[model samples]
Target: MSTISGAHIFAKKALLPDGWAENVAITVSDDGHISSMQRDTVPAGNSVGILLPAPANLHSHAFQRAMAGMSERRGQEAHDSFWTWREIMFRFLDVLTPEDIGSIAAFVQMEMLEAGYASIGEFHYLHHQPGGTPYANLAELSDRIIEAAEKTGIGLTLLPVLYQHGGCDRRPLAPGQVRFGNDPDRFAMLFELAAGTMSRLPEDAVLGVAPHSLRAVDEDGLTAAIALAGDRPLHMHLAEQVAEVEEVIAARGTRPVEWLLRNAPVSENWCLIHCTQMLPEETAALAKTGAVAGLCPITESSLGDGIFDGVRYTENDGKFGIGSDSNIRISLSEELRTLEYSQRLRDKCRASIATPEKSTGRVLFEKVALGGAQAIGRKAGALATGGFADLVALDEKAIDLEGREGDEILDAYIFAGDDRMITDVWSAGRHVVREGKHVKGDAIRAAYRKTVAALRMRL
Candidate 1:
């Protein structure tokens, strides 16, 4: 099983790079890429219904999955916003050991695969112990993330984050933020160590860099991170909240997005997470830069962050993608649904994301699938020869999906049905999810349960 090579797959109907086709046959070679494709072919090997290219979740904080429902309570502040939620998150993460993080991340990855995501861009930042100390190995926490990816067979773009300060003023990291703090020099060392650790994973695994956010890293640090990242993916938080925007403006003499576009070489390789606070010009300008706007609708709504300008950005031909973010929920359908619904609610109109030629669901799925793959630097998002065989199969027999064909299948899945219709998922030719569950889910869930139980007692 060391090499899951020379596999054949058939689908009743699939969304190919050209368009939808029936009776599709795909061949995966030893290197985990689609080697060939045939249409109107006889069923061979594993057969599936309504197959499509699965998307990479472009931004995830895997450790934050454990704090899903723990920060729902209203704090003493009159308004409990992302700041308040962040405080609770900081407190919660303090108790997580490397082992705990590994287990929790594995569980999160399993859920992502079952939810129909074939890959993930883990915006990992937790790099040290509870206090302000590093482990014997600087990349201990990052290695845990890699191990989790290995266990779950999720295509991972491990982004080792560089967090330099508490805010844009370059103040020292707060007590709760201590564990994530690393100067530019220290971060360089940590990144190298993490890269060495990532070599143990499969060839498809990517090591990227993230400079936490404008509030977390300075100009020199951001430059260092970009240089360190080279041509690989580079993700960062940008204007996710009003207070954050104001803070960046106060310290940097411009808004977060404006500052980055002017100061850094923002391009297709960059993924700016949560541009929910951008002005019209900023949206149009950033769209032209070819950077992906990573949206986390569920977590943004839960945190009371403002809605993103989906219609305007799309009008400008912007690239964007979805992410589970805090991992409060891992439903790929709901993420797409929430994105479209949020646009409709903001504009007080239906089909806000739909174009003249395509349905809402079709536009959402296709755009996000392609944009997500680009953000994660994965050669996927389409059933094409030479691309990664990252695919998802839905239950065509489901009541909601009955009689659906072409784009209508995507429409029904996102609107009427949910991830429950996801029957299988393959990440880089590895059939990790089968018959609606992860292959190693039971053991992963058991470990997560024990870890959470111990964490609760400590809290």
Candidate 2:
């Protein structure tokens, strides 16, 4: 037997960078990347159903996962905007310990693996304790997130976020915001500490930096963050709310995207999350900068955030990726489906994401996979020699997927099925999911239930 868990995978049909191929055989090396591949080859292992490259969830606050469904009820305010929802999030974080976060995050990653996401870019922001003191180990919470990823076998791009001020005016950190606050001097140390935690991660794991958002970081702090991040992947939230856009415009003399394009050395290394409120000019210009727009369609709808200008962005050939932000519902198919459906609703047209030749589902899958891989700075989103072995297998036996082939398989799954159609997943050469369930799903779910139950009582 091979010393490591190196192995082979065979698919009757698999989607490659160019297009779908038949009788594909993939060789997984001990280092967790494809060593070689052959088309129209004999089965190397059990011949599976249609195989597809999975996308990285490029923006996530893993700790917010625990509070997914608790905020749906109406609050005392007549209009519960993103601000009110943020208040609820603050209250929830005040009592959370690092151990609880680890368990919650493990569950979330397992769900993502089972749902056909090969990797995650965790935009982790909660750093200190409830009382605003750093742990003896500055990377204590970062270590917990890494532990969760290790347990769940999910590829992680760990982005340690630097959150300084409370708003555009550089106000003091609010009581609920202290845990997420840090100075430039301290943030540099935190970033290094977080990077150190990745030594134990699987191959293809990445370390990145996030400046939170303009509301949380002044220009000086943002510059400091960019300097520390260097050429690594840098992600930050953009205008997800009208109030936030207005605040940025009033404070910076321009909109959020406009300011960043003019001010920051924005490039492919940057990922701007939630461009939900941008002018058409802003959209097209930002697209030309090569920064990937990190979109969370489900969470955007759930939080009442406005729709993204995806039509304009795509028309301009903009790069974009999807995320399960807030983890309200982690479904790979749902994220892409919601994205296309939103455009259809807005434009009143079918196949809004499709080229005249390519099907909508095929285009959506390829675009997200490529864009997400770029945002995370990893070798994924394709099946070829030297590519990370990240793939999802759809159950051809599924009643909904019966008799489907090629693009129709993807179209049916994205529109008709959920995770139920995903029979297996391999991330970094490990078969983490089999038979539509994560290998560690039961144990992770048990721990997650226990943690959430105790947390509910406190709430």
Candidate 3:
């Protein structure tokens, strides 16, 4: 269904920036921003039980959703680490055509919408075909990603990634990594073409830049990427694994986080993904920089990556947001749950992220909502005038959330419930999910199933 211009949404209770409010009414302009908001108002237009500012999934590799459950078997290595799992990922992508990418991305975006994420910052790097052959159009894969966002009606932040080398030693791209390689000049052209394709999306769609990782992009390439990004969001993978830390230290005379902070102008515009292996000093320093820590808790656990020092970082006033990095799972509640649980498991403390004034769920939901918008460069993250209309509603009638008010509502919905309580989702005024289902859920699922079936046969 096409979104109605100047649509109105009323909520029985809403988690506003200041605090929870009751009987809230909001208006969305044709441009997809909240034109006005009023509290203590009568129910009008599309009414809901509970409302929240839905966060953007700040870091994602959308094509990886197809390979979710296929890599669980044990490998020859004594310990199946991120490196070993990556080999399987490389093999999986060799068979994915542009059509497969489009189908898989559409399904992933649809799932994100249903999971309560209103937008995505897709860190897209798969550029060439098998054997490292450039397609007729350089931005073919990016176009597929944009088309997927359009079909799902989810807000898009397409971060065209620049991946140059295979390791810190500046080695040639490996056979599996070749499809993601592009020299700085060629990557600039690819980024430009990708930006051109983004006009197919809504006005809220953003184009950002990512220097794939410290291992993949050299100092010069990273500088070029920062230049390309200008003032837009610039994301990078950093210090996700122990091996990666050792390699960066051996090559650059410093750890990943330390090296980047000393070398680059790290600021709020940059989002560093998976800083799961940081020293306390590095964590404190990074927090002071105002850069976003793009955490992917589920993927980190799946790959056996170490836990981030979230307590130390937050104490230093760090900004953080959650993402479905590997796309193995996309539940927003589980991401927050896994993050808080990891901290508790490490420190043997309860309510690791909760403050004296706020419960665990309230703190996590509010922090992620604001930080995610900052990381993706979206004007959202609050039920206030001038923010994008990215909203999620929960079922008050659900047993988990029944009779809950204020912070108690968030506490129960997150700790005692899951995305099942997400009854409706609006992405930039586009009401994509209603009654816990995507408007095009069936079609997206059918396409994904066919693609995965053919993919399995090929494997």
Candidate 4:
């Protein structure tokens, strides 16, 4: 058992139905779950700064971390959309050996820990060989990913992705997509294999299923994947671009979100990523479904995706979470800043996402934490008994946070500060980051640099 006593504890702030606290001690069992939290008392043996439950990154493609800054070169003639960028991504993945993937994933997860992300929902889809040939062991790629998480100490929610086709019409996958393609039967076997591998991870880790996108799977495939998911979390890319919206409507009878609502069983367990181009009616309807809108504002902006209707979504009580999708820029505060800034640009107002009683940062942070925790199917995002003891300690001494307290501290951190202010982080009661650095940062980064050098030679 371990005990951490702090000057202030933001226990249950994100999910206890009431928010924020101070002068609390949190206890955790040897098995990594929170045992209890005592208010207004300092336990003997440990001392710390302000503490708060860390947030889970609801969506990530860990391998993309390797290609972070390499895609910025302008193409020969014209506009570069997400589709065009995907080609570069496919080319990049063609050279990633399983060892390379494990190294890069460990590096990314280490960065996530330092940035105050306790868990990751890895939306893994790079499955087979370069030419679509299956490895002798189907689970080889996924095992590397699980190994990466285990080495890094970040809580894992591995979402093995099913990519069946290139479009909604059940069109054959393009040559570049071979590595990601899987028939429903093959996908089921992979899912079972993934589950077995997940059982070998740290006790808090979990396995989930992802149907790559509406463009990648047909109606029958989607239905089968959902049934296979059972009660586990279901995540998918949906309506991320205007082109995708148009394609879904052209192929199906409706837009992606509308088609999903009509056809799929989307409930609380689902997370629809990048719902960027939704109509007001579609947005309102989605808000009622209890599914999380997995928003990656920095990545969306970097990729030229449109702004989400945050004000309207919040007014409708829609759930949402932030992610560093591409990992091009991995700062949690930057994601929050970009999310709110994008809304402000669209709405032409300051504090567009703030409610009457809450600051913009507080509202954004709390909502995303709740939404992400729910989507990942974890008892985290709050410091409470039975919750995973995944917590972050901010450097109150940081310049931007010098005089802040309560919601103002969140405001300064999100609006002005960056990951540098995140001094320490713990995942499932294990200290993985301290003094603003991940415990394994240097070693992981050195390994990642070697992998990147090899990938660059091939790319």
Per-prediction backbone clash count = 0, 0, 0, 0
Models ranked on lDDT: 3, 1, 2, 4
TM-score of 1: 0.99
Clashing pairs in 1: none
Error of 3 at 383 (Å): 0.8
Local distance difference test values of all predictions, in order: 0.92, 0.90, 0.94, 0.84
Per-residue alpha-carbon lDDT of model 3 for 265-343, expressed as tens digits? 9999999999999999999999999999999999999999999898899999999999999999999999999999999
List, residue by residue over 6-84, the lDDT tens digit for candidate 4.
2223332222336566566777777677787776675443345557678899999998999988888877659878778
lDDT of 1 by residue, 69-165 (tens): 8887899999788888889998899898999999999999999999999999999999999888999999999999999998999999999899999
TM-score versus the correct structure, for each prediction: 0.99, 0.98, 0.99, 0.95
Off by over 4 Å in 1: 1-3
Indicate whether candidate 1 or candidate 3 has the larger lDDT: 3
Provide the clash count, candidate 2. Answer: 0
Worst 10 residues of 2 by lDDT: 1-10
Error of 2 at 189 (Å): 0.6
Candidate with more favorable, higher TM-score: 2 or 3? 3
lDDT of 2: 0.90
